[model samples]
Target: MSKLFTPYVIRGLEIKNRIWVSPMCQYSSQEGMPTDWHFVHLGSRAVGGAGLVMVEASAVSPEGRISPDDSGIWTDAQATAFQRITGFIRAQGAVAAIQLAHAGRKASTAVPWKGGATLSTREGGWIPWAPSAIPFTDGDPLPHEMSLDDTRTVIRQFEEAAQRSLAAGFQVIEIHMAHGYLLHEFLSPLSNRRQDEYGGSFENRIRLPLQVARAVRELWPEELPLFVRISASDWKAGGWDVEQSVLLARELSAIGVDLIDCSSGGLVADAKITAGPAYQVPFADKIRREAGIATAAVGIITEPHQAEEILQSQKADAIFMAREFLRDPYWPMHAASALHAEIGWPKQYERARR
Candidate 1:
């Protein structure tokens, strides 16, 4: 039997397999609402046989969006719009998940194809928020340093977003604490330069992220799992590293977080990162071992045997594939064949299963 094709249980949810689709931003929403593109983009992956299909980094609030086109769940209408997508994923035997995020200093940017440059308020963009008034890029405008009230509002946003996710029919909620986003800014000393209780020292830096997790867990159903995606390493000296991630994982687990989705870098523009196939698997292995928690390994994890090795070796509890899933939405189906694992294909595609 293929370890990658095995069912994994967490809380009361049993994912059909270990192959999960990573949250990849589509940059195709209209005023934070998912359009037909989202339905098709996500629906195809469900049909493709992933055990879990996570929607991209959706903003908890409008200002939390990475770009004007990013998805949002700040309103009931948005939550209602997601019901169809989630229903389809469930019918296809795949769990539907959503990643709630705040872009922080990275907000107010144009889409990638539009050069991804920062936009000013006059140009239809709002000022971005961050732990410190620092710009992500040298020439970019400084972001608004979040005040105490701002922190409280953010916590409320995450809490409300979690409720919306549940109402939207999602079975899992993955908090986006990675990729240099708002929560990540507070965790990394490189970006969080505040002198208050939310900055400086390890405990203070983690205060807000912890609070958000606690608030979300309080309301999220106890039976459903909550996952957190973190940049296990900033890939720069004197920045957030694996040791700190292990500590954070422990705290999250205590607060009822079920899984740590491990990915590295994205804290700085110039951090020297050595990227390769399964380059990030070690981080997941270390966190799972040291933190005594479940972890999902991501980052350039392509191919069937490669994913099987990670799970068989107990390096990670699950696998999250991004670009590879985009390239081949039916990757899990193909991988099952490669591993000689007997799995059901969608009845609609049964003829092609042979």
Candidate 2:
């Protein structure tokens, strides 16, 4: 079998292939609950032969949502709703995972396709919380600076969410520490300007994120894996950079994080990102080597050979694709054919396999 089709075992869970679906938000939830839309959207990718199917950035609290329609696991009802989708994914021989997220200063905005403007409280928005009260940009609303109590509560919320995710049958739990979300806000000095133990120096900035990761790891079963997505670089001068990411990854590994899902930018609005095919693979490669941890390479990794070469070069343990998966749900099966590797088709779709 090709490296891309090789089974990857992390801890006690074995993922059937290196091709995993990156969580792309559909923004189609109802009051944070997964509807049938989620079931079909996620299940299709599983049927398409992804090794892992991850739910999008789910809010740990209502205010943590990027918009009113973002998926969440803050309630028992939402967890129950996810059961059907997880069952379908597992049945298709794919590992079911969920990305737990808190948007922080990036929250309370309209969905991307809907202009993405900041929504007022009357417009079904709430005040967003962050490490600092800074607005993402000059025109963005100033987020409320989190108090010590708020910080502790948010950590507890992540622990509770992990418990709920376990009950929902997800085998992996990925913490969203990337893309300028709440945790990223704390990690980047440009966004985190607080004067407490949760801010200032690198150690202080990483305090809350570490706490949150430890909390989740504590609740998450040791037999499963815990992943943390991180913006390897803010792509701006004096911001979160690769060196910091290496140190962070090392620290996370010490806390029992299984892998670092490497991506870039999103800490600031105007930072220039020179994105291209496999642009972010270097981050994963560097982290995996220097930090001595497994890493998932994401962003612009589309072609079959491209993914194969990434694994063959040991750049990353797995390839996470978002837009490519959205465009072709069966990219994995297609990749298998292109790479001349054998992969099984769903029994119902066997007739359609060439």
Candidate 3:
């Protein structure tokens, strides 16, 4: 039997297979509400046979979004809108998941296809928040240094969003602590240089993210598994690295995080990332072994045998694909065929199944 096609159980959640769909931002929301675009986009993956279909980095509040068009779970209406999408995913025999995120200094930016520049207030942008009063890039607007009240508010926002995610029928909640977002800004010294309880030293730096995790954990159902995605390395000198990621994973696991989705290098613009196939797999492998926690390997993982090798060697419990899934939502179904594994295809598409 192909290990990649085997069921993997986490807590009370049993995924049908080891291939999970990574959260990819569509930048297609209006007033934080996902439209038909999101429903069809996410629904297709579930129909395509992924074990889990995760929504993109959804902001916990208006100011937390990466762009004005980013998704959010801050309102009851938004949560209600997600019900149909999540229901569709579950109906397709795939677990529906959502990533709760705050962009921090990276907020108030234009979407990638539209130049991806930091937007000014004149352009319908608001001041971004961060652990320190620093900009992601030198010329970008400086973010507001988060006050103690701001920290508490964000933690509360995560708890509230978790409740909303539950109401929306999402079975999994992945905390977005990666991609140089708010939580990540606090973890990396390169971005967080404040002299407070939530910054400076490593313990202090990790304080906020851990608090958010604990708060969300308290609100979420005990049966559902919680995941946290982290950029294992900042890819720059004197920044957040794998060692810190291992410690972070251990701490998160202690507080009920079921899996660490390991991806690397989104902390800076010119951090000299050495990108290649499975370049980030070692981070997942090391963290899983050292922290005694489950990990999901991501980053340029596109082939069946490569994914099979990662799972079979105990490098990672599962593999998450973003671009490949975008290229072909039926990747898991195709992968089963490529690996010669007898996995089920959607009954509606059985005639097309070879």
Candidate 4:
């Protein structure tokens, strides 16, 4: 049997299989609330047969949203809305997870279908803020640097978000600390030029994310699992790299983080992504071995054999796919069939199982 389909335990949480649905921004929320689009989008994956179906990067606060339409759990009302979705995922036997994030310098953009440009207030978008006043690219407007008070508020927001997530019945809480978003902007040298405590050295760069993680960990139930998504490589010189990622992973694991979802790039516009099948798998292997922590491999990992090799090589504790799942919601069942792994199909689709 492919180890990729094997059960793995983290803390007290037992994941039925190794396949995970990587959090892909739905960009379909209404005022940070999960719409029916999110329900079907996420529920289908659980029905498709992944062990863990993580929700998209949910903004912890209004300003943390990647776009005006991104999902959120900042309030009890929002949490209540998510309860239905998580309930559905659980019924299908997949662990429900959420990726809590603050977009930082990457916030206030239009949805990709709407041109992905910085949104103006006139067009229903808010200004982006971060650890420093940096623009993501040459064409993007400058973002307001967050004050010390703002930093504290951000941490509180994450705490509240975590509480809400638990209330909504999410089993795994993943702090989104990577991909050139808020937390990553503080970590990457190219974006964070601050001389303050949140910039300059690695300690300063990782401080806020660490605080956020700790806050979330404290709020989260001990029996549940926690994960942190990190851009293992910024894909540029003098920016966040594998060594720094390993260092951060070790620290996170010590603080009860269950997995490091290893993804790369999105630090800056100048980054040249050398995309290929399993391009970012190396980062997962490095972090898992070097840091002695579990890691989730993401990127162009589409095929069953490719996903199997990652587990066989001890690269990642789980296989996560975004685009592949987007293309085929039944990717998990197909992979199970192709790999000859003995995972059963959803009872509703039993007749269609190969």
| Clash count for each candidate, listed in order shown | 0, 0, 0, 0
Model 4 stretches with alpha carbons more than 4 Å out: none
Query: Which pairs clash inside model 1?
Result: none
CA lDDT, every prediction?
0.97, 0.96, 0.95, 0.90
lDDT of 4 at 163: 91
Q: What is the TM-score of each candidate against the true structure?
A: 0.99, 0.99, 0.99, 0.98
Give the per-residue lDDT digits (tens) of candidate 1, residues 1-354: 899999999999999999999999999999899999999999999999999999999999999999999999999999999999999999999999999999999999999999899989998899999999989999899899999999999999999999999999999999999999999999999999999999999999999999999999999998999999999999999999999999999999999999999998888999999999999999999999999999999999999999999999999999999999999999998999999999999887788767
Cα deviation at 338, candidate 2, in Å, is 0.5
Worst 10 residues of 4 by lDDT: 345-354
Candidate 2 ranges with C-alpha deviation above 4 Å = none
lDDT of 4 at 104: 92
**Backbone clash tally for model 4?**
0
lDDT of 3 by residue, 1-354 (tens): 799999999989899999999999999999999999999999999999999999999999999999999999999999999999999999999999999999999999899999999999999999999999988899888899999999999999999999999999999999999999999999999999989898888999999999999999988899999999999999999999999999999999999999999998888988999899999999999999999999999999999999999999999999999999999998998899999999888888899976
Tell how far residue 340 is off in model 3, in angstroms.
1.5
2 or 3, greater by lDDT = 2
